[model samples]
Target: MFVRNGTSTLKKVLTCPPTFLDEAAPINEISKKYQDQPLDKAKLLDEYQQLLDAYAEAGVQVEQLTPQESMTNSVFARDFGGCVKEGYILGSFKEPLRYAEHAAYEEKMAELGIPKILEVKKGLFEGGDFAFLRENIIAVGIIERTNMEGFNELKAGLEPLGYQVYPVPADSRYLHLDMCFNLVDDNLAVAYEEGLPTEFKELLNKLEIEIIKVPEEAIFQHGCNLESLGQHRVLSLKQNKDVNNALREHGMEVIELDITETLKAGGGPHCMTFPLHRV
Candidate 1:
């Protein structure tokens, strides 16, 4: 059983290929709610390919799921499920359009010989809000997609496994906690002040974590949502010039990719991946 630590060296990951985006196709509720602008289908495909290539270069195996024509937001696979110390912990998406993805994640976990440890079935909880800070400290955001009920359920499941759950209140504008804070390396993290509450920062202080504050502009641009590939290596959006520079200045090897089209669908590099095994 492999443990699920986001900052660990990633061994294997799963992603969903961007589905066919027929702009002419009638707009669904999901698209209406999330997509702030028109999507460039071709760019989305190119961007995803670049992401896969980055993973390959980092010596990580990338597996992709067949695209679903009906689900426009399927590309953001991180919200579908999460990897824990025991096995996979499946999530129930708050949006109606994403609920169908539960079955897909379940099947993928089974194929990989990873048992389903638990499922957030009764209430909403997306993997995006769940953050594994250490071997025992787990930070969960009570945000739009994740509520108090879901937070309690996750705590109930993880407490037995020796985990301390910290509930962070997420800004309504941001989708998840990761939208504001993410681990850059062991004992280090990057966060956007505007998206974080004072108590949450105090909690990080108590944990003795070194925090790098990303400029407020970068937060809305999805700069804080970058992914760490262990050993101080990071993958961030190309457009996030300020944050990328900040990460590099802090001694991190930064890999940048243009995710303009993908961001339109409400995610960035970290949101695109569902890591299975990290060492």
Candidate 2:
């Protein structure tokens, strides 16, 4: 749960880093495999800072990322929960090879001034795949990165915090809920028309939220990724053409920034910025 704002609101968001547990745990290996990234690694860090700058420029209060051991995948860094009063739930990284990703969140949360970090021993939960749909209900994607154990942990922990958790089956290709849908605003979200199941759409419809259609291929491009900062404010990657159009068409003011490097690592602006609070 990264803050939509800047350092002014650090404690409000939750975040984590990558570590060695799974095959993707060693980042150095990744560097050896890919010689020329479509987006440069050095530039990715700069672009990530730029994305963070945008949030700061927009009155967003950011909490820095949680520190974990070096892992090959940033996806490991993202396997954390939104936020809870008692603490943030660190979901087990479904990639057994990367399962240790959850371990990093504890230190990150402590640095953010939130000392309590909760973990689910019984299930696997991924924050990337969970969405706070309404007052007490959250929609989670049941996939490889997230499992029944994660689902149960999210449900049991968040429900008592006044968040009702629901599971949505996902297409194996994308492997993440954010790859399919994201809460762009309080009343609207960008959803991949084909990436997610029909039942999930039906359930979302039941909540009265308007789902803006984002193409399946676009989602693979990470177009559906977004973060809501209240007051119709949004954080997203500038490269996602279709998603930007969908957000603007809905009358929401968009803050498009560059995060090509970060996204290529399997996440985008939403993945980089851990919003501390919405308001």
> How high is each candidate's TM-score?
0.92, 0.81
Q: Tens-digit lDDT track for model 2 on 119-183?
A: 76777666677677764567888865678876776677666666666888877566678777888
Give lDDT tens digits, candidate 1, residues 180-247. Answer: 88887877888876677788788888888888887765656787888889988999888888777878
TM-score of 2: 0.81
Best by lDDT, which number? Answer: 1
Counting only residues 3 or more apart in sequence or on different chains, how many pairs clash (N, Cα, C under 3 Å) in candidate 2? 29
lDDT of each: 0.79, 0.61
After superposing candidate 1 on the true structure, give the runs of residues whose Cα lies further than 4 Å from its correct spot: 21-38
For all candidates, what are the clash counts?
0, 29
Q: What is the lDDT of candidate 2?
A: 0.61
For candidate 2, give the lDDT of residue 144. Answer: 52
